[model samples]
Target chain A: MTQQKRKFGFETRMLHAGHIPDPVTGARAVPIYQTTSYVFEDTDKAAQLFELKQYGNIYTRINNPTNAVFEERIASLENGTGAVATASGMAAQFAVFMTLLEPGDEIVSSSHLYGGTKTQFTHTFKKLGVKAHFVDPTDMQAWERAITPKTRALYGETIGNPRGSVLDIEPLAALAHAHNVPLIVDSTFATPYLCRPLDWGADIVVHSATKFIGGHGSSIAGVLIDSGRFDFSSFPTIAAPDPAYHDLKFYETFGHYGFLMKARTVTVRDTGAALSPFNAFLLIQGLETLSVRMERHVQNAQAIAAFLAQHPKVAWVAYAGLPDNPYHALAQKYTPKGPGAVFTFGIKSDNARQAGKTFIESLHLFSHLANVGDARSLVIHPASTTHQQLSDAELEEAGIDAGMIRLSIGLETTEDLLWDLDQALQLT
Target chain B: MGSGPSLAVDVSMNTILSEADRAKYMDPGKIRAALSSTKTIAIVGLSPKPERPSYFVGTYLQYEGYRIIPVNPRATEILGEKAYPDLLSIPHPVDMVNVFRQPEECVEIAQHAVQIGAKTLWLQLRVVNFEAARIAEEAGLTVIMDRCVKIEHGRYSGSLHWVGMNTEIISARRGQRYF
Candidate 1:
């Protein structure tokens, strides 16, 4: 018999691409390699492993079979050369900075980002001697103006959190490429199935696999995908000899796999944001259904957005799916599938905060939560929940409405979801 | 494959080929077997609007007991089932991936269907891609281009006669092949 071609589909890759049936037991499902450490066959092999002469599992913190499968599958989906799995989304972001940055290096970031990420960039990174410049994501000129001699990378989300501000990725990628800086996109919201940033000129992509990628709202994991297209010859981090790894020049040795190699061997090994094998299994399950869930998420969001837009109580809706949205055109070009399921809307009332509270409380189907991109629809009143600490002036400066209602549409029946929103809106 | 080589398919052809003409390119038995065995379908570019033929076909298929997964980014749900933005995003097994998209979009969807392990790729009426069909067939998936699954099911399942439509199938076996 002739050997068959092994060109599998996306779902096939999700189930079988990164793995084969166990030679020992004929097991079909990916077995969770849950051991903490692997034993070496001999002193010579162990020595070679320690010397980085050969690649093999030594420790779970450095690499594991389960995590490797998750990493490879995501890398395939994202159209990346390689990927490094981390403990969480924040860890993935940290690993990127840890691998690329020096003491005096700077990062140009979008002003609109998850509050946690903003704090990490502004406070945590500053303490580590790296400065960050925040710029409006919509203004390409502003991004250019923020870049300085010390700047190493440009960072932004595929879709802005809370506000649903879509990034003009192509222009920003151009800006970063012109300056010889890598554009790192947090594509957690717009998964690779919807938009592959690397195809549009991005150098790096990061994701909080805890959300949609994990679909059922279980497990927390992150991944960093390298396009392997960026030239790191000028960057001292990847190009120069690493004292930690005994003079291993990542760029010179690994070539296209340089970034991922450094991220794994240096950042992940030292910082230790390694994903658990069990969590990797959960993520695998999520990845398998990502296509279907994302479509439902988009459909539910479209229905809810239409409902909110026509409601007399809704002051304004800021969903890219909506025709009047400022980012509609950009979203259509970059993410033609859908503008994503998460969006923000203003609830109108005499005391907008009271109305927001009523609307949130009245909903039985939608869960009031801090997270986004779950299998279940989630709602949060930003002014009262996440942005409660910000003063009214500060909230306005951040472009957050006091009565803003953020919705993360999930995989649910449209009729039930619409009914839930309708009942809640009537109360408001 | 739709035609021997994608290069062989003329770009100027404006209509679907006749059964005899298509027989030169594909096997009808492959499509019949795919429809008979398929249990779940992930419909790419499924519209939420009721008027769309994709919606009605999907609804009718769902009513017939085949699991229908809606694949479109704009809608979260269709006919009570959670929708996916693309074929790759669907977490479960898909027996077939039905395309309700433009011919230009077929290649990407074909790649996604292959990646997702879908057993077959069924392109709706008037939408066809020889390149996509070639890719799917090469990947070992059964490919049925420029045909409606509902029409195929009704024809093969002996349901078309009840609706007064010609099944074009001549056989003594008139019972449903699919349960």
Candidate 2:
């Protein structure tokens, strides 16, 4: 009936939510909990844990105290009830799907996505008998037309990979909810500092903590955060009795925590894709400086996208932060701080593909790599590598041209980065 | 505040409690008042299983010198204390009624708490029922919802943060013992 502002800002939660000082040693920082299993107080306690009748760590494959802090902090930042940490973003995504989807279940997802995810959905999921329908992320009608009775969820990226199209979160979330399904947003690019998708009505949020969350590029990790607002009492996979756990009905039993509980105890336990406590610890360190890193990441990206937009050697730049870009308004609405640091541009030359290769090789600051969201700048020509096997028509359909050079702008000095870009452009 | 069906909200972590709700339900002052003045807690739905949170909490509270009354239909006694099937069956003075039951089951439990004239009605984490909270409030019983008794005690005693948990209380001052 009444409302009040939440205490603890993003930065505060990032540094402190999941952990407190070590009581024994008086250590201020989180210590790496490297052990595989915990000691049970007695035989009864061990039985209780094995039965899943209580909450305590039975094995590292499911959860660890060190990873618990990482999961909790991520959940707090994303405004979710809880989270499950996984080995990678791909693993996190898989854990969620495995928990929610059945053999015949389907999902309607945005066509523009990280190439690895696309392959996972199209090829890998195909083997699992789960169908994924990809539609233009920006077109509301296209998303609607793709949903079927078997569709269990609507999926999208907060920021489209390489294409620079920001997802229409609010509307897409509404569409998913109206269909009695959840919207899962891959917000790897627009980290919670930039956009909290759960605040926009998404039921679940997944992240590649390997990227921005682990700003130093030191660890590969991922997390799945659940808003706990969706009523899954009617959703079959959640509400129905799970045969694996002695006919335990998750939603009816655990209520708001049903999905995450199932995701952890069953999915991660059986899947064997748990995030090691060591990696979780590194990501925790990365989280401590997330807001600081993201601010600079966004600032440099806005400047770099602008610089390349007007360059004579650049044919086109697709950065939502640019005013003339199609998704600029949506970007302002969803990610007003900036449209994330990763974006794409094309070199203006007759043999643009060759020029793109030369441009990548000429850059001193930007490393040519397949990853994005690193603290260091990265350049990738998807057509020549990630999307190399795709025909020109396939590339065009995916909104990537042969000359498309995706840049993940880092926190380097803006002038130095601009100089690097300038020199590389001249070579192109 | 009146007796009726009060739906427990599944509020996100970012949406903190309302000022009125905080003062009435989550305020440190109110929680302290409930904890310091109370010596006995009637645990409704207190599972006998060792791993169940309610059982562990009851065990901890009993160890802390509070008389824990376990209310489970099937258990004759728990943690060396007598068990009652319902609140009304307890013939002794009950200082607080702590609940680990479902949200929908709370309205009836609140009525029993009011009937038994308990001083406080406390719900465990994720066990919030606003109607029950309102009923207990209307009956002049102190109501604390969606908070764990063990955690609150640990927090106030300055031990919750020992394991890297944010107490949400920043202080150069240490937590003072109340009991």
Candidate 3:
């Protein structure tokens, strides 16, 4: 009888991938292997690992057993060939850029981005002579026109931050591939459960595992997952021989795994942004219940979006689930599970800045914070806090309104959350 | 058995070359059964290098409680087990012959496997040879091509997905999550 290859579902992989029952200790759960160095099997084995001729842990900076489990599990969920974990989400982006880009290399990115990302892309990248061209994520023509010969990558968040605009992944991927560039997606808002961008043709996926992947605000970690489908043979960085490692040609040697291996050994190793093993353990625990947590998070978000839309104090809601939302069709196409739990709304008042402050301070249940993807509900007024430095024109370019209050709907009782929002809206 | 063609397993290589019934050969049930039943595996082109794919696969199988015969003429022993130069050199019975050599070398290895009366012939990941497969299958040997024995064992045992392996197989049957 004919049979198909057996792959365990997402939930199963969460619990099992990269984890073997520990034969020596009989450890059932993924053990916290918090060590800076590992004992080599022999001199030959040690040499082999250092030479990149073998896969084994020589140092925590390069690979660890605990981190290996997390990396593999994330790769499995993202449907990628492999993944590498780093210190934070920014580190993941930095590692990718450091691997792919040379001096004067360019990136075309979405303007609708997390505050920190905007700062990194615009400011830090400037110091390195790399340029980032930000465009309206919805404008495919804008993205197309921005790409020049020097452009190394096309980038965007899957469900954009603050304003919940959905990226057109299919067309964006097609556009990037047409120009011999890879589309790098920050899928922090829309986790693998909501939308896997790689399945939609993206080459690399980045995530802040600190948020939904860790569910609780317990860990700060970042990961980059590679689809292994992109051809890097013609690309300068991956295909070229490296002087640092005895002129080893990565793409010629490892084929699909060239970019990721270099990112780990060369970038992560040189930069020293390796994730703490203890933090990786926390992320692993968080990942086990990801699908369950995400379900409730989005469910609460949809109800809260609906609640705020009709409220007298609220002037506008940017949730893609709303019928009048401009990104509704694209949300259906990409993140059909709703455009994530984080979204924004504007308060109707003449003194909008003061009113936004009042709305946040009046909240009893929601914790006013600068973070998202926690079990507890979170609220942030970006204009007064995150985007305070940006000019009116700059804020408009980033899709942020000065009066906008961002709500990352969490796993709270629907009625209780609505009551909190109602009281908060009254104050606004 | 000698390295020459066997009278008992005389067959046409061209008749089974296309492999129209390839699915039957790759059937998950047969693979699981073959893996479970095979006691001894002869790894062709087994390397002495600790980092090589053949070495690690042999080590992993040994850990998984399967006796592995490393077929390398250069190495006297590997992973603390005796290493034979070729499949025919293995005096004891080998239930499966796992090929790690190039596709061009597999046809000869398959012929040797047939002569030795091995039950299954497993080609390592990226080692695809339809002609070798045809020869093995026509001689009543189960053919598993272009797959890593270590990865298949790990997949079955619930411990792979690292080192950039593209894990596409999903099943309704849950694996051993906790041991």
Candidate 4:
């Protein structure tokens, strides 16, 4: 089964690519290994597993069989060496940072990022003595200029959160490579169907599996996919033995899986950020229909973006699918199929607070919660809700005005989504 | 566990000072004193709606033996108390004025809180005003920014629900359990 053909379309792969029937039980469905500790053959086998000489699970916190299947499936989907399943998207980002950075190191990242990611990079990492240099992800030169000697990675989203700006990954990846840094792309918005950043030159891909991957929004989880293209041996700090774990060098032990090994052993092991087996099971179920759901998501989003663009009340629309959008050209270059479900629009009203409130309150089908990327359409006024913590200047920098409304188009029919949106717009 | 001694000192200090002050000065003793002494609170923009955080927090504090004055211009009353239009309109003294308005409206609220002789200005979680916090602090009022009072109360009082593991055993019989 492991020797099966690798070439298959995403939908086929999503169902049966990386996984076969369970070896022991021959179960077609992935089994949930709810146990915490895995049994070893003997004492020597346990030592071997602990010493990284073998590759079987010792503990569920580090790895589990159920999660391994999910990891393999995601890794296969993203074209990565290995993947790590985490407790949440935030935990995934935390695991990545903990594995890659030391105190006083820096990350060159796009200024426009998810609110939680921005907070973690700007506020939380500051406590750890790691600095984040915010740069324009669209501007290749800004990325080049931001890379200093201590810059560890270049980070951006394939489609930026709320703003829906599509990043130009190929050139940005080249810039990162020139600086001896890896490019980490958050592909939560543009799931594997719309765009696979690895094919476009990204070294690492991250996702909030709670969003699209778990399509129903029933589970909160995240994944980190290592492309295995970045050479750890090129950077002495990452390759060298450390005080954190008994002087065992990551690169020396695991070649292509070096970063992933470090991420598993150090970050997930110590921080206890392992994904729940139940959540992994839910995510696997979601992946079965990912390709189909994503297509509908794109169809609905395109229709909504178009509807808003022509509306008299909408001052600006920032969906990449729209031809007049600033990100349309980059979207064509990177994600030509369609920008994933999320996009933002602005109301042309002075009483933005009232307009924003009315728009949200008037929506019948769209839920107005803090989360996005659900099977049902989601909407929020960024100026009053998601990006409310950011200052006016910071909001402007994030391309959010007081009247801006972020919509996460889901699997609903295009006509229904447009009708709901049109009535809401009329109310606004 | 190895850093238990240092962590104890840190927690003790944190008990006395506000989290914002601790982040600024690393003094926890001051936080504990401020918390213990604050008995009366005025919640600005306190909604009558039970679902809102302000309403629930105010109710929780009231249940915990603290006097709560709801201040909202739009509401005539909330939680059976006659709501004042602002802090200045309150008949009694307020120890802490909790501002639940947007960040842009915080400065005016902070000034009113000071004018009403409030001892501290508390901004709900995610509402930040550097200028307001600075002004309140300068006026000899304790200022806490981007923190939920109810969460802090629960955390400090050890009321947080813990799942997973129990180190100690609970027995109905006297000294019956053995490890």
Residue-wise C-alpha lDDT for candidate 1, range A1-428, written one tens digit per residue: 11211234555445543443433455556679899998987886676556554455789998887777677678767767668889999999999999999888999999879888999999999899999999989888889888899999999999889788888888889999899999999999899878889889999999999988888889888999888789898888989988876676777555556788889888999998899999999998889788888988998898889888999889999999899889899889988989889999999888888788899999999999999889999999988888888887888888888889999998888999999988999988
Candidate 2 vs candidate 3, TM-score winner: 2
Listed per prediction, chain B TM-scores read 0.83, 0.86, 0.79, 0.76
Candidate 4 lDDT over residue span B1-34, tens digit each: 0101111222211123454444542222333445
DockQ-based ranking, best first?
2, 3, 1, 4
Off by over 4 Å in 2: A1-6, A391-394, B1-18, B28-85, B99-117, B123-140, B146-179
TM-score of each: 0.70, 0.86, 0.81, 0.68
Q: Cα deviation of A65 in candidate 3 (Å)?
A: 1.5
| Best by the DockQ measure | 2
Clashing pairs in 2: A19-B164, A19-B165, A20-B164, A20-B165, B6-B131
Better of 2 and 4 by lDDT: 2
Model 4, DockQ value?
Answer: 0.01
- What lDDT tens digits, residue by residue, belong to model 3 across residues A1-428? 34432446788877765565544555767789989998977787676567765555778898787888788788888888789999999999899999999989999999988879989999999999999999999899999999999999999999998788899999999999999999999999999999999999999999999999998998889999998889899999998888877677777555567899899989999998989999999998988899899999999999999989999998999999998999999999888877799999999998777888888889999998889999999999987787788876787776667789989889989999999999888877
Please write out the lDDT profile of model 3 over residues B50-73, one tens digit for every residue: 545476677667766799898989
True contacts kept of each: 0.00, 0.02, 0.12, 0.00
Question: How many clashing residue pairs are found in candidate 2?
Answer: 5
DockQ metric, candidate 1: 0.01
Write the residue-wise lDDT of candidate 2 on B10-83 in tens digits: 22232235655655677665666688789999999998765455766787677556899999999999888889
